[model samples]
Target: MSGWKEIILLEEKGISVDEFVSGFETPNKLILLEGCLDKWPTLKKLDRDYLVEVCGDNRFAVGPAQMTLTDYFVYSDQAQEERPLYLFDPKFANKRPDYRWIIIGPAGSGSSFHIDPNSTLAWNAVVKGSKKWVLFPPDVVPPGVYLSSNGAEVACPVSITEWFMNFYESTKTWKKKPIECVCKAGEVIFVPNGWWHLVINLEDSIAIRQNFVNRRNL
Candidate 1:
């Protein structure tokens, strides 16, 4: 990757809210905050068994179909597809109002390029395993991605793995190369509104992601 660059990383304790606001407002860049969720109970308690015990019976959207957590786990364990089904439930906030999602997926499972809806900023925190992220700025549409005239819909490669195989290298020669990083457990990645991003799990993973509107982005 010729122009490859890493997103800025900061220790959570070292940056004040005011400082973060200032930097975030001026540059509006993606940032990786380390130890941001160290004190969250989910970091220590969230796992497949815990999730199954609490929400096992609740069905979640997995690709084109819905399945319970217990069933999804069984499917994921043996899934050998190029793009495995990922558990992404939008209605999770109804059960736990504080968060928007409890994402779970096996290795090689992930989302394709797309922007967050409603132009909201988001933060994704990995609780178990790790994820690799590739992001392009709002002005740059990622390679192999197509958007409708009204931007209401997106068309991209069939799978994350396919995109990487066919398009990832092209980004390297781009003047505005994508920001890339591997976010591990206990770390958080702040995605600015309108950034085009794709995420792939490095291994069987569990994560919490929330989208929000703040004064700067609202």
Candidate 2:
């Protein structure tokens, strides 16, 4: 028998994002980033017309800043402010910055499957339209999760997690049965740290979220 195989037995487990955060030992690096859409001013101000106007020439993405979706989104930046997120600077991250957000739609965004700043955990909440998501554990990425000329795949380092490499299900299957959620106007979610995710807009979506280290340091 294989020597390494004898030490561990793995199973495909279905877990809620909240449960995943609570059960793991690592400090959660990501959470459903939904703060703006939950409030009144953002909600009332975000509308179809407003989204179109904000997008302006930056139509790479746009949506009412108040619409919320508990889904995923793809990558787009028609009107991005040309900031550090595009550059990925670990120095600018908050001390407990485990989570981050994307404003999808006309004034917001159109983001795709990618890693968070510094290979940390990440999650998103759609404030407006439906969005799709995909994830792979740290190990699945052989060398590491880096954007290369090829695609999402890359030569990862040894520190990567085994779950990522061992996971056998195709993204298509996972997408078909992924943790489909809708954040509505006030709901929230918690995505564990180091998990990979992808998003696609279902409508002109609007939402906000933040990255925070789990308060308990699980």
Using TM-score, give the best candidate's number.
1
For model 2, the superposed segments whose C-alpha errors exceed 4 Å read 1-41, 48-102, 106-109, 142-186, 215-218
Candidate 1, 152-179: lDDT as tens digits = 9899956898888889888889988888
Q: Give the per-residue lDDT of model 2 (tens digit) for 44-66.
A: 66654565556433322123222
Question: Which parts of model 1 have CA positions greater than 4 angstroms off?
Answer: 1-6, 95-99
Q: What value does the lDDT take at residue 161 in candidate 2?
A: 25
Model 2's number of clashes is 55
Top candidate when judged by lDDT against the true structure: 1
Q: What global local distance difference test value does model 1 have?
A: 0.86
| TM-score for each predicted model, relative to the true structure | 0.92, 0.43
